[model samples]
Every structure is written in structure tokens, then in C-alpha cells.
Target: AMTVFAEKYGVKYLAAVKCLHKDADALLAFYDFPAEHREHLRTSNPVGSVFATLRHRTARTKGALSQKTARLMVFTLVQAASKTWRRLQGANQL
Candidate 1:
């Protein structure tokens, strides 16, 4: 089930697995993601203009989701929305 979800989303399953083992570097390498992206993950901030949209979404939705599942769903949606906004703005440097 996890593999299916990862593959469907174009996510690196090895990275997700390595994350469970706390092997941060291996997980980053598995995704072929730049070290800068790791910084963004650590900071919980988008790399460019997406940051503004993410900030706005988080602020507007704070404390609205009481359940963990609902919060995760909201977060995923917000992330996708922010990415789309960044792409439309053509300001995604990473």
C-alpha cells in the first residue's frame, strides 16, 4: 500500500524508508534533491515565492483541523496549492 502510494505520487520510496531509519543524507540522495531543498525541509519553508502562499495558507487555517488525519490532509492540499502558485508565478528557483 505504501509503495503504491509513493509510486503514484512520484515520490522516492527509498527516501521515505531511509527517513524511518534517520539516514538523512541517503534519503536526500535517493531523491536527487539538492542540499538546498534539505534546508527548505528543515525550515519548513518553501524555497521561493511558494513561501508566501504557504505562509498565508497556514495562517488562515491554523487551529481549524482538530484531528491529525485532517491536519495532514489539509497540509498536503496546501503544499500542492503552494507549488502550483509558485509555478504560475515562475518564481520557483529550485
Candidate 2:
């Protein structure tokens, strides 16, 4: 699949193709999991969302946060978000 993509569109997306090639194993590592859990793996954007949330909240504070305060805020926000996250569907497979 990556080979086909590289052949057909690599020229137009050199950087992307390079990254895909470099991290091919990591990117495809999700397939080693159960099929039922693949959806969760594919849609896992929690870290990005958390970072975005942190950025928005911090931007409002206009750089007034100390390192300790920022760390605490991020930890609290992640803990809150984790409460609403979905559970793995095929835990039995593991």
C-alpha cells in the first residue's frame, strides 16, 4: 500500500511520503492489534486534542503560567478527558 502511494503520488508529496517511509513500522503497528480495536487505534487523536486544549487555555492566560501551574493544569485536564474516553472493544484478544 505504501509502495503504491509512493509510486503514484510521492513526487507531489515528498515530505509526507518520506515520513511515511521513515515511520512505516510505527504507523502500521496498529494492525498488530485485534480487528475490533483497530477503529479505536485509527481514531486515536486524544493527545492532539489535549495539546490543542492546553494551547487554547494557556493562550487565554497570555503566558502568565508558571511551569508548575501549567503541568498541573495539563494533568488535570487530561484526567478529566480520560473519564469520557471509550474502552477497548476487544480486550479479550489481548
Instruction: For model 2, name the residue pairs that clash.
Output: none
State, as a TM-score between 0 and 1, how close model 2 is to the true structure: 0.59
Per-residue lDDT over 7-44 for candidate 1, one digit per residue giving the tens place of the 0 to 100 score: 56545466675454575556447457555455545544
Worst 10 residues of 1 by lDDT: 85-94
Candidate 2: which stretches are off by over 4 Å?
1-32
TM-score of each: 0.24, 0.59
**Could you tell me the lDDT of residue 61 within candidate 1?**
75
Q: Cα lDDT for residue 81, model 1?
A: 66
